[model samples]
Target: MLRVMNERAVFGEIFRLGKVSRPELAQATGLSKPTISMALADLERARLVRPIGLRTGNAGRAALLYEIRPEAGWVLAVDVGREFVRLALADLVGDIAARGDERRKGGETPAELVARLGELTRELADEAGAALEDITLTVFGTPGIHDKETGSLQLAPNLPGWERPGAIELLAGVVPDTPYIVENDVDLAAVGEGAYGLGQGVDHFALVWIGTGIGMGVVIDGKLYRGAQGAAGEISYLPVGEGDPLVNRGRGMLESVASADGVVAQAARLGLEGLTSAKDVFDAARRQDPIACQVVAAESDHIAHALAGVIAVLDPELVVLGGGIGVQAGDLLIGPVTGRLRDLVALRVPMIKASTLGTEAVLLGAMAVGLTTARDLVFERAVAQAPPG
Candidate 1:
């Protein structure tokens, strides 16, 4: 027990400080020199730590600097989107060693999609010189709520046949004995923003994603608040209209009026010309076209109503706008939405900003998730492989 505790102390110090010599580690962990040596020797044998280089500033003789070996394990991060499947293969230290992306063909079956994901996983692992079984953690960012009970996805209409029984089981069966996770894409975006984007210093924030779909990712006290059954941030179901809540269960009332399809439909209703897509509508609004401006204003109002609910419930300190349409059309939406939200919600409104990570938010978030899981897995392995007390 003492040996395990000492090893944990030394490893924790190294993880927190990045690099340290034996003497510095001893000083930081408050462990004796011989104990530190033994702990380091055991860690090295377990392939968890390695000597990096000689410390330069020392006097008598240069002592060796040690760092956690990044190549000790691997993490696979996947972003499964409606049109594209993006992946990043990272090391234990969270450094991306390889990346690959492929566009989804129309009418592709669920089996085909799973096969493509498996193929991409193998290709990336091979490129990084890793075997499938060697991957320490695998995280999949999908566009729906993962139903842990049935082990299938829910509310993911974009990925057809994914909700069918035995689909998720098949996907999980592809990689045996590996720790796999399925997370909402937007939720992962919030995680990514927290680690590498605007939510760095803020403890309480909400990430609103508006695209083909609308969703929010809530972070409170610096941790994700996944409610009962992991549906905490499913804000699309907010009743902004006078309709019955029971009638608008599947794809929320707010999402029906504030998503990309909603924007395009509004533009079509306004008789906007050459507007075959939502981007054209936002572009027209940017150009100050009267009808396009009206549509954008209405969309902004709808989004504000949705955010009003978010603010009222979570009272987040900041609201981050992400997804394809949210980040691109932030300039046109922020002003009106902020103005309207101030009127709808009684409390102080949170500062709204566009995402800086852009399309890479979910991908980088997958990396963060994988990195977290990898750290825990590595530490557990270290403890289990420790010499018997």
Candidate 2:
């Protein structure tokens, strides 16, 4: 019992401080020199901590600096989207080692995507000089809700063949026996923002993602509110459109007017023919094209209408605009959206900001989640293996 307690104390300090000498560990853990020494020895024997080098202070002798063995385990973070797949590998201490991204080919099925993810994972592990089995945890960020019961993705029409049965199982097969999780891309983005971006220090915030798809990630009281069935932030289906809500059930009214596809459709309606992508529309608007500007204005109004609904209900402290279009066209959207929102909502308008992390937000969120899960898994296994008093 005493050994376990001492071990946790020493390990916790090292986990937080990154590196520490015996004397420093004793000071931080409030333990005696002998206790700290023994704990350190045990941790080193367990391969959890290692002596990095020497720390020479203006004192009697040089103290040996110890750090958590970064190679003790690894974490894999994967972000899967219709157009691209990004993978990042980090150690137990959250130090990233390898990062790779691949543009997914058009017409790939979910099975093919899973295979691509597995290939990417192995490639990343190779770059990190680690094996797949060494990865302690893997967190996959994807668009749409992960239906735990059916083990399949739901409301993810963008990814072809993703809703098929055993989809989650296919993902799990990629990292067999490793602690694996599939999460919503925008939800992960919200976590990324909260942990490292504009949402930091704000207890209540929402991340609005607009691009190939539209979604929201809500953070309440510093915790992600996934809601029943893990579909809390499906803002795409919000009943705020002029069209018949019933007919637009799958695509949602707000999404029909606000997402990239919606923006392109609006541009086409405005006589901006041959606009291949939403970026072209934004570029046209930048050139002050009358029709493009009209479409952008209408899109901004739709965004504000949807945001008003979110602000009215959640009343978040800040709302972070993310995704390709949200961050790129921020200057174009913020003013018009805020103005329309002010007209729509009686409550105070939430502070709106653009995502600083950009496309990497989801990957960072995956790393955050993976690190957390790996640490807990390691500690839990250690505790369980300890002898009872």
Candidate 3:
């Protein structure tokens, strides 16, 4: 039993850009006027759509305009990173109504983090004047491999104790009854960029985030292509540098040269110290510090070298650089990376750009995942309750 009637109402509201009369819906869906009226009434009762004034195109006679209710149901999105947790509440239309971020100690367990997230979600819902019950879905993006089958976080090197027992189970217990989804942080950022930012129009693009570590998300044919076992875009392991044989090999490949730690390690090899993190190096580069300039230049060269391989293989239409370091470095990275790419590939360079969403990309992506999940759930429920053919 497909809830054909409910599906019609949702589709009508989704496709209706302006004031769409019942006559128009009848024509579009090929349903009778009575059926359209019934669907609209049901949607109104669900608070999913409402009349919004009238349309004026038929000889001074106004027909009613209907719109999908943005606040009918909400989504709670959380981005749990190594150093911070960002939470946001968003409507069906992807507008953030409330947001907050908090820094964390390096070794906090998932249970501790889940408790913090529960508090923030409730606080955000209160600020938006909505009840927790109004949240139809919850999605989180974190730094790790998310095992969909077991719904667990596995092997996040940056967070100690993240892989311990009951991490995902505990978080689920906290946000009970809500549909929960978890994904790698970088993957979510790519989804966010595709849905709401620069990657919207491009079908093929690469989102590379260079920060404490290097991770990438690849989009092909307008979809996030998470490979089998969800390890498709783990570019950090791509080998690129010289260090202790075993330590260098164990660090994987790409992380050795392009990640924030990679840059710091490179600086240390040159006997540079007193540098706190990649941000310090970037700030110094801005101020034209000689050591900073040299360090950044060398790191940029490595990043570009890696990007050239991605371009040659993926041939994406755009490469979006994000994360704190990528956003700040901008064309400083583009020049060297693209230059290296140009030398490797015979084809013209793809458009290289910065993420407009900044650090909020993963949060926004979680919202999108939640919204889509909710919509699908609504459809599934409708089908289950539909009358037997």
Among the numbered candidates, top TM-score falls to 1
Candidate 2: worst-modelled 10 consecutive residues by lDDT: 241-250
Q: 1 or 2: which has the higher lDDT?
A: 2
Kindly list the per-residue Cα lDDT of model 2 for residues 53-101, writing each as its tens digit: 9877667888899998888789999998768888899999998899998
lDDT of the candidates, in the order given: 0.84, 0.87, 0.77
Kindly indicate the candidate among 2 and 3 with the higher lDDT: 2
Estimate the Cα RMSD of every predicted model relative to the unseen true structure.
Answer: 2.8, 2.6, 2.9
Candidates in descending TM-score order: 1, 2, 3
Residue 248's lDDT in candidate 3: 34
TM-score (all chains, Cα) for each model: 0.92, 0.92, 0.89
lDDT of 1 by residue, 13-49 (tens): 8877888899999899889999999999988888889
The local distance difference test score of model 3 is 0.77
